[model samples]
Target: MKRNIVIASVAAAALLTGGTAVAVAGTQSSSTGAPTTHAADAAGTTAGESFSDAAHASGTTARASFSDAAHAALKAVPGTLDSLDLDHGARTTWDAEILGKDGKWHEVTLDASNAKVLNQHIDRDTDAEDAAEAKALRNADVSATEAARKAASSGTVTSVEFDGDRTPVWEVETVKNHKERDLNVNAQSGKVTQAPSDDDGDDD
Candidate 1:
């Protein structure tokens, strides 16, 4: 079990790190977690446009393009625009199924700086059996937000998505009464979706 930082403040709830929220058994909360635009892409903008502006500016290109997007997002974050960095190697930006606080899957994406926010989408097509498995995981302390992809081998996460949308997450699973529990994680910089689990089969 690895231990990572968790930020729960609504003010700084951006997903800066890569995909999925990773955690160990007993973790603590902390500060600092982990942005956004377009003309800024063509001519660059000030630090007043919401973070989303920077994300959509570059669309889907290369890591360098994302770097440019990160710079743009930093410039538009509101204040004097401090420093910003983009890890083109983040997994959350590419994964498809991101967990959320509601113990459900959601679409997620985080900027290179992980300081801004974007909207969330859900996977309506996940097979009911798989959905049930995911729900079971959620019930076993698994975070609905992005969960750190435990490296199976030495493969890089190409692209990620939840059902179909993009989003961020912190924690996913927990342990209660000696049993793994399911839930959502928002330790540090990340996003968490809240979708009800009442949809039976009309999700498709």
Candidate 2:
């Protein structure tokens, strides 16, 4: 009977040791799985943040095209379009100058996003230069839109400004391959030509 008791005690101890080993293995597996889960979650969060940043950047860069802004300006003040410039301020805006039918120059500000008219006012400050520009615009058979189209072959037209020098022309700025190019479109003949560079050392 004593020998039988000893054998039973040995069997119980072995069972206990096996159970302890299984418990330790289970604890180790749980610990390993927890770190992997946390790592996966962290990776997902980082990817989400990166995607959000890219989306925000795209939203901020979105803007109304120059053509749309011009149309909005002309609608606000009916006249001959003179110049349109993209102005960067607290808000992106388009500063447009138009010669109104009332023989006055009107400055119109438009939102760059939706081409909404932000402000409009007559520019009372006129000079001989302004008068010359107006006369040139009146005589030009090629409209600003035409000038832009003619210069489109050069690149994307960014702005169009009137140049009332001896040879009246529409000074159009274009961007091609991320490089800025200046082209002169004859206001009367709709001819496109390269504009003189600032460092060309031409007095005229």
Candidate 3:
């Protein structure tokens, strides 16, 4: 009877020890899984931070570059003296002092969003009556020499002058019938401004 009791006690002790070992193994496995989950979460957070930082930096750089370019371009434009604000957009009409290739001061209208050349008024063309009037005026000058007549038949002359300001009917030089000639024309009322003169300098 004493031996049997000792055997039974030993078996119970072995079973308890085996259960404790299994529990410990299970706890270790659970702890390992938690660390892996935490590691994955940290990696995801780091990746997101990196992407956000890159996007923010890119946006900042783009804005700075665009601002710099815009400032430089605006400075380069000449005669941008004043600006006007409109309902839809601002109308930036540059100073009308900038002379174009046609020997006339031209005003440029630019879009507020983008600087675009909307319209341009360079030089005015001479009309038939203005041409005749100019010829008569030049005829009055005795000392003046006359060149072949080149009519401004294509268009009418808004103004004619030696300098920037438009004066009375003045001289005109044009190509008519494939021939270049220096003629005189009138500005307003199409009166005789000047006659054809060869001795004076070129009309245009």
Off by over 4 Å in 3: 1-151, 154-167, 192-204
Q: Where is model 2 more than 4 Å wrong at Cα? A: 1-62, 202-204
Go through the candidates in order and give each one's C-alpha lDDT: 0.26, 0.54, 0.22
Ranking by lDDT: 2, 1, 3
Positional deviation of 141 in candidate 3, in angstroms? 23
Q: Which number leads on lDDT?
A: 2
Error of 2 at 62 (Å): 4.3
Q: On a 0 to 100 scale, what is the lDDT of residue 131 in model 2? A: 77
Shift in Å, residue 17, candidate 3:
99
Candidate 2 local lDDT, 1-204, one digit each (tens): 000001111101101000001100000012222100000000001111222232232233325545566667766776677777655557656677777767788888887567789999988878887777777677666666667667756544556777776787878765443356788999778899998888888677
Clashes of each: 61, 0, 13
Clashes of 2: 0
CA RMSD of all predictions: 17.6, 34.0, 44.5
Candidate 2 C-alpha error for residue 101, in Å: 1.0
Per-residue lDDT of 1-204 in model 3, one digit per residue for the tens?
000000011001101100001100000012222100000000001111222232232221111111121122223332211111111223322111122222222333333223334454432443454334333332222110011011223111111122112343334332222223333533333343345465677766
